[model samples]
Target chain A: MTFLRSALVPILAVVLAIASGAIIIELSGLNALEAYKALYDGALADRKGIGRTLEKATPLVMGGLAVAFAFKAGLFNIGGQGQLVIGALFAGAVGYGVTGLPWIIHMPLALFVGGIGGALWGMLAGVLKATRGAHEVITTIMLNFVALNITDWLTSKVWREPGIIVRTPAIESSAEIPRWSQLPTGFALAVAAAFACWYLLERTTFGFEIRSVGLNPEAARYAGISVSRIVILTMFISGMLAALGGAIETQGIVGRYEPGFNAGLGFNGITIALLARTHPLGVIPAALLIGAMEAGGSTMQFKADVDPEITEIIEALMLLFVATPILVRWVLRRRDTSEISVGAHWGDA
Target chain B: MNTLSRYRWWFVTAAFLVAFTLFTAEFQQAQTTAVLAATLRQSTPLVLGALCGILCERSGVINIGIEGQMLGSAFAGFVVASSTGDLLLGVTAGIACGMLMGAFLAFLSVSLRGDQIIAGTVLNIAAIGLTSFFFQTGRSLPSGKTSRIKLGPLADLPILGRVFFSNRPLTYLTLLLVPVIWYALFRTTWGLRTRAVGEHPSAAETVGISVVRVRYMNLILGGGIAGLGGAYLSLEAVGSFERMMTNGKGFVALAVMIFGRWNPIGAWGAALLFGYANAVQTQFQFRGWLADDPQFIGMMPFIVTIVVVAGFVGRARPPASIGQPYSRE
Candidate 1:
């Protein structure tokens, strides 16, 4: 009964969101059922559809893990976009700039560089918060703009391939993450990373320390945990995970460092993290659901003349409903028993 | 010495400006005037957005939804103005839309005691999605520009006139609003009660203040101001709405609020500084100094925000219970 009660809110929220979306569609003079049918068909019909969904889900899973990991440490790493950008930049640089290296050395080296870049970028905000009392939220948002302009400058000026196009050269063949006949290898890596995150958060002492700090920093400090160190380490790991996602996307799907190609993947991480209730393991399914919507968005747009941005609307609605689970409980007429305050550690922690 | 140390960044910025002007011959008298004028114009939305942040944060609400509110208002303003050909109607529509969003935020974060940041994030995503979706579906509207207001004698003043007198009505209103907001926040009895509620809600309640009511009012008012900022973007700045047209200005306004230490006048100053950076970047592009690659130049304001927020300027202290939801037991 407890489990059912806990699950009811999310389920009801999703249903309500879809119903609201249906209303909007109907009001727009479109047949809601036909539009939904097109959405489902595009998302699940063919092998290509499934592949695209997984392909999109791969980055989302990694990004979701990044956000969820930080949430466990009571940090909102809004710099996921910035971190991912730097990671992709370094990975792309390594992928195209380096030569004569075998695939075994090249691929991992590119990924490592990307991870390090992301980690370093993430550490900037962490270090600022730890030392200077600057808010991570503000710092991270600023970093996003900085990252965008930096990447744009680099691609358009420094790393340009002597062409008019504002993108880096295509990565070498050796640097690519080799895929199976149909499946992207990055998807498999994402699943492994998700499990690794789950294991790290659930089965490790470090994870315990992180959760302790998240639950109560004063207690964690009294318990002899170095709060600042943990915060920095957690942000570093979170950034590395997000960076790895961007690197994989560049190597697996995009093949180049193009501005705007990886746009919103980081922001979408917030949705994925919130929808997963900040659980590392739950991020996989949440990411997959969002990924499927994104994968099918174009198809839906083409088939039903519905805008692809409707997926974004649905995602946002889900976030709103999930964020305010009280509304769900009120609609369902359930007594309030959950004591977990999501923003308990918002500012001080 | 303390004042000098506190305002050291101001002096440094002044020195940098002088040196920049001396080095760049393109920054002639006419170019300087244009840049100054553009800076004031550009800062209008930022000032209004900062006011929104100030009002919300002062009342103990963390409104990261300023971006979303601005976007919603921009869309509302653009649609109404284009359809009705009445700028005032458009502006009102924008403010109403913003207030609606503010009310929703208040309902979720205040009354329901939901996670404020998550509520804000949800608001942003929903605003972007809804606006873009509607924009895609709706017919393209007229893109008539807002007529500028010119003061007779004030416009004749050399540099000050160009910077302050000649602008869209919204720009003037934004400037006028700073002192008004400052007075309301710092002078009035209502302001005192609001601060008391923000700092110590239980105590405020004991003193007969309605904490929820104060927060809701401030949030809605902030939303209206932010909506005006958004409306300024569509109706005055660009004459049309685009997807995500606020372009992180709302977030930057939060930084401005912090830089100003949650003071309206301080926020206006910070907004002007940021606006100057943007205007200078535009001027550099115009003069072919950046060779059309203004991307690096564009990063100035954000980088500067980080430096300022990292306590290089001065410490920014938010309200005591800024992000906390007050529940009267």
Candidate 2:
């Protein structure tokens, strides 16, 4: 009963979002049913389709987990994009920079290095907030640009492949994450990370401290919790999760670190986290739903003659609906209003 | 002397840099004037966005949705102008779109009591999706861009003429807005109420000022300002619109707003500094100065913003009640 009550809003939000998306499709002179059908067929019709959906879901789960973890500490790590970029670049660097290692060693090494790189980037924002009271929103946004420039420079200059293309050399096969019938090992790792995050947040004393700080920092501090340490550690872990997503993209999917491939993936994490109500376990299903949509986007466009970006519109609408449950409650005639609080106050940590 | 003493090193460094650059053979007076002019042009949108931020934030509403407003307006302005062949109509359309977005933001953040940041994120995402979905590839503008205006005698002044006196309509309006908005914000009754509401909405409500009304008005007004900035980009600067072209200017404008300490004149100065950095970046790219490594040059403005936000330069305090929704009992 409790699970049903908790799940009702998100399910309704998705339905409402898709219904409105249908209207948008009709306005665009396309058949909504056909577009949705195409989307369905492309995402879950066969083994290949199932494989593709899981493949897309892999990074999304990591991204969603990253945002959700930060939300637990009342920190908005908008720099997930920057952290992801740094992670991918570093993973790519390790993948190509080093040679002759065993497959087990090289792949894990690259992934670990990527996560550390992302953690460092995230920790930069955490340090700024912890020490200087700089707002994470602004600093993280700024860091995204910095990460973009730095990565672009590295790819175009220092780590450029032979000629013409502004991309790093392809990673050695030894460093590549193994895939089983279109399911990359990253998806398993994502599920494991989700469970780990759940355990950390629900079962551990440290998780309690993090949640305490998130709920009321003053009280948490009074209770002898080091709010600064929690903030920093949460961001560090969040960055690692986002970076792991980027690393998996490099090792399992993209083969090389090219700018723009991972564009909006980090931002999509925002939508996913909101849709999941920032629950660690819920992020998996939320990610899969978005992943399926993305996997099928090209098919929807091909068959329905509608642009693929309509999915993004639906995603945004879902975010809006999830963020403002009051709107949903009014529509559904529900009385209980849940306060969805995430992020820290502006100009302070 | 006391104030000047605080900034003595700034002046000294400025003078030393000018002297150092003057000796470089590549530096010509004409080229330098051109760069200065470009700097003002580059800062037009940024300054306008900052002013918009100031208005909304001063009313206790955090308008992180400035980027969405700008992008949506830019797209609308370009589409309307290109389709209808009327530049004025396009600007109006742009402003209308921005105002609508502002009202939506007001509805979500004020009436609905949603998370201001998440609402902003939604606006940004929706704007990007909607604009890109509707944007056609081969549209051409029938009317040319808003041309530069010559300020009669001032147009002939040495360097100041090209940099300030001669510019597009929006650039002049932006410059005019600094003092106009400063006076309005500092000397007017409405300004005091807005500040009161931002600092303490309960107190403002106690004083019989409608906190809700003030926030709604300010958000709509700020949205219009951001819309004007969008129009400046498509109709004045490039006379064209590209998907996601407002880029990160809206976010950078927030940084400028903070660095300016939420003051209009200070914001303008901060905008000008960023504009100068952008102007230098463009020069470097054009002249092949850092020919082999342009990315570092591109990163300068963002890096500077981070440093500023980290309080490395100076600390800034936001309004007391910012990012909070007020409830009436």
Candidate 3:
């Protein structure tokens, strides 16, 4: 009964968001039923469609885990975009820079380099927050612009593909992550990462310390847990996970680092995290749902003459409903028993 | 000595501006008047956005939805102006749209007691999606630019005329709004009550002040101001709306608010500083120095924002209960 009650809000939020999207479609003189049917068919009907959906879900799951991990430590790391981009650039460089290496060594090296790059980028905000008392919200927002510009410059001038195109050279074959007939290895990696995050956050002593600091920093400090260290380390892990997502995209999907190719993946993480209620395991289904929407968007546009941005509207509405769970409780006529404060530590942190 | 130390950043900025103007031949070679004019023009939306931030934050609501409000207003202004060919009506429509967005934000953050940041983020994402979706539905209106207005006689005054008088009516209104907001925030009784509510809602309620009402009023007012800023973008500046066209000026306004230490006049100064940085980058691009590397030039404002927030600015004290939702219970 408790599990059903807890799950009711998200399920209702998704249903409401889709209903709103249907209203929009109706207002636009399109048949909502037909559009939805087309959307579902495009995302799940064929093997190719399923592959595309899984491919999109892979990065979103990782990005969701990144955000959920940080939330457990009472941190809002909005620099997922920056970390992802930096990781992609570093991983791309390693993928292309070295040659004549075995697949095992080269792939791992590239992934490690990308993860480290993201960790360093994430740690920069962590250190600033821990030492200088700078707000991560502002710092992370600023870092997104910094990352965009730096990566653009690097691609255009430093690693230009010998043409007017602003992208790096194609990565070596040895560094590529192998894809099975229909499923990509990256999807498996994302599922593994989610489980690993769950274990780290729920089973380990360090995870307990991180949770304690999140709950009450003063109490954690009195208990001899270094709050600052945990904050920095949590951010590092969060950033590394996001970077690994980027690395996988470069190694498994794109096979090259192109500007504008990975634009909204990081921002989508915010939506996924909120939808999942910051749960490590919940990230998978939430990511898969959003991924399906994105995968079906183009087909919806092509067949039903609906704009792909309808999907974005649905996602935004879902975020709004989930963020204010009170609205759900009110709609369901349920008493608010346990209040999980999502952003009480926002300014305080 | 204490006073000197307090305004040290101002002194340093002034000294740097003076040094750059006097030493850099490029400043003289490139039309200095043109640069200054551009700086004022660029700062108008920022000034208006900062005022919105000031109003909301002063009333204990943390409004990061300024960007979304601006974007929504910009779209409304452009659509109304295009449909009616009346700039004034378009501007009014824009302000109305902004108020509606503010009301929505208030409903989420204040009534629902949701996370303010999340509410703001949803506003931004929704604005982007709604505007883009509507825009894609063959609703592209004819492009028409708002006419520039020049103040009589004052327009003839030397360099000051070019910098201040020779611009659209909206720009002048934005300039006039700075002092008005400052007076409202510091001198008026309503402002005092608003600040009291922001500082301590329970205490304010004890003194017969309605904290929730004050927040709602200020948030709507701030949204109107931010909407005017957005209208300025479509009607006065770009003369048309594009996808996500307010860019990140709303976020920049947040930085300006922090830089100004939440003061209206200070926000104006910070906006001007950012405007100056933008003008300098444009001048560099115009002179062909940064033509090949526009990305770095595009990065100037964000880098300067980071530097100012990290190094130059001191600890910014926000309103005590800025992000907290108040309830009578």
Question: Candidate 1, what DockQ?
Answer: 0.60
For model 3, state the Cα shift of residue A120 in Å.
Answer: 1.2
lDDT, residue B71, model 3: 95
**lDDT tens digits, residues B154-222, model 3?**
987877787888787888889889999899889999999989988899999999998878888888999
* CAPRI level of candidate 3: medium
CAPRI-style class, candidate 1: medium
lDDT of 3 at A307: 85
TM-score of chain A of each: 0.94, 0.95, 0.95
With a 3 Å backbone cut-off (N, CA, C), the pairs that clash in candidate 2 are none
In the range A61-116, model 3's lDDT, one tens digit per residue, is 98898888888887888888888898888889889988999998999999999989
* Alpha-carbon runs more than 4 Å astray in model 2: A331-340, B1-27, B312-315
Residue B32, model 3: Cα distance from true site in angstroms: 1.6
Worst 10 residues of 2 chain B by lDDT: B16-25
Of candidate 1 chain B, the 10-residue stretch with the lowest lDDT total is B136-145
Which residues of candidate 1, in runs, are more than 4 Å off? A1-5, A328-349, B1-27, B136-143, B313-315
Q: 2 or 3: which has the higher DockQ?
A: 2
Q: Which candidate is the best by lDDT?
A: 2
lDDT of 1 by residue, B60-129 (tens): 8889899999999999998888888888899999999999999999998899888788888888999989
Arranged by DockQ with the best first, the candidates are 2, 1, 3
